[model samples]
Target: MEIFKVEKATLSSVDDLKAYHAHIRPFVLQRLEEFRETWERGDEAVFEELVFCILTAGASALMGLRGVEALRPVLWSATAEEIAQRIHFHLYPAARAQYIVAVREVVRNELGGRLKAWIESWRGRDTRRDACVQKFKGIGYKEASHFLRNISFRGYAILDKHILRSLHAFGVIDSDRPPSTRNRYLAIEQRYLTFAHQVGIDPDELDLTLWASRTGMIVK
Candidate 1:
């Protein structure tokens, strides 16, 4: 099957964000507002944002937040190694300690023993989204999407189960199997980018809105 390139659209300001929000369902619009509020509050530090993304990968936002809350004490009072140890122990009971450790190592190595440095490096990178994601540990397409969407990376689209289902239902893509590999995910990502352009919204913003709507946290 051939996938054609989707023409990109431009959105330049807050007014653009609001206008795009208005075109979505009320539930989706409400969630976009909520996500924008929450995302704006914690986007000050890129490393912290990435760490939050790592912790939340494969988990719902609420669940990820709980994990972040659990690690906050260590984040405040301990070194990175100490924080890693505490998180390793804390998540051990949940059987996800290894993945957490993997992510910690990736961040540590990529940042050159300093979290701040890693953030700087990430912000400086000019590679494609998938290439950037490949540099991180335990971060495949889905995890990468979760991380990128939260940070509002331009032109990136997330492909979680709900989003995939929604896309299929809307006839945006025809697929029987879920996106479980890099190539498959990229294909779906292309579809999502097309849908976003057609709907006149940023792909990442659209993802946030969809997540919020599906999770039922779209406030009136």
Candidate 2:
């Protein structure tokens, strides 16, 4: 196996994000504008966004949205304990319920009893992305990336199967290993960061464009 080298890339502005998005897909400009409008209208809290991210993991956009819809009320009106209890009742496969409780505990411990403070801390700290994500018991690389992307993490890229396949098809990454391995995720992320830099777009925007394009979501 060839070891992949990590290259750090950063997107410091919205303009950079827009340019990258456009490079990835010509229609991304309108799509991103639409998503931004929806995001602004909803004005979801960071913690709420994180919960949505978790719900969306390894699922289709429509399915993810349905899960988020189910999760939203619990997030907004219920305490963490209450949310944990209710999520299990509605969300199935049993493991998802366990994940909810584990995440709640992580937030309580990591944020020192304040979800708002944790959200604020997340925005400023580069290292906190991984640390906060890893705190959730069952969250792995793809889920973590998906969660961070929802919140528009500046330097981070999401590596879903569609994006991974696209990258491999474009010769940007080699698909020689199973998707469950850490090395595969790392390699995909490294390649995506490089591609984002080359195209002058933030990784988050790149992810949005790629997902939209692959999923056939109309942007506007």
Task: Per model, state how many residue pairs clash.
Answer: 0, 1
lDDT of each: 0.55, 0.55
Which pairs clash inside model 1?
none
The number of the candidate with the highest TM-score is 2
lDDT of residue 158 for candidate 2: 61
Off by over 4 Å in 2: 1-44, 76-92, 109-113, 119-126, 176-184, 218-220
Candidate 1 residues lying further than 4 Å off, grouped into runs, are 1-20, 23-44, 76-95, 113-128, 218-220
Tens digit per residue, CA lDDT, model 2, 139-162: 677666655544544456567676
Which tens-of-lDDT digit does each residue in 30-63 have in candidate 1?
4445544544554334445555666666665554
**What root-mean-square deviation over C-alphas does model 1 reach?**
9.5
In angstroms, the error of model 2 at 9 is 27
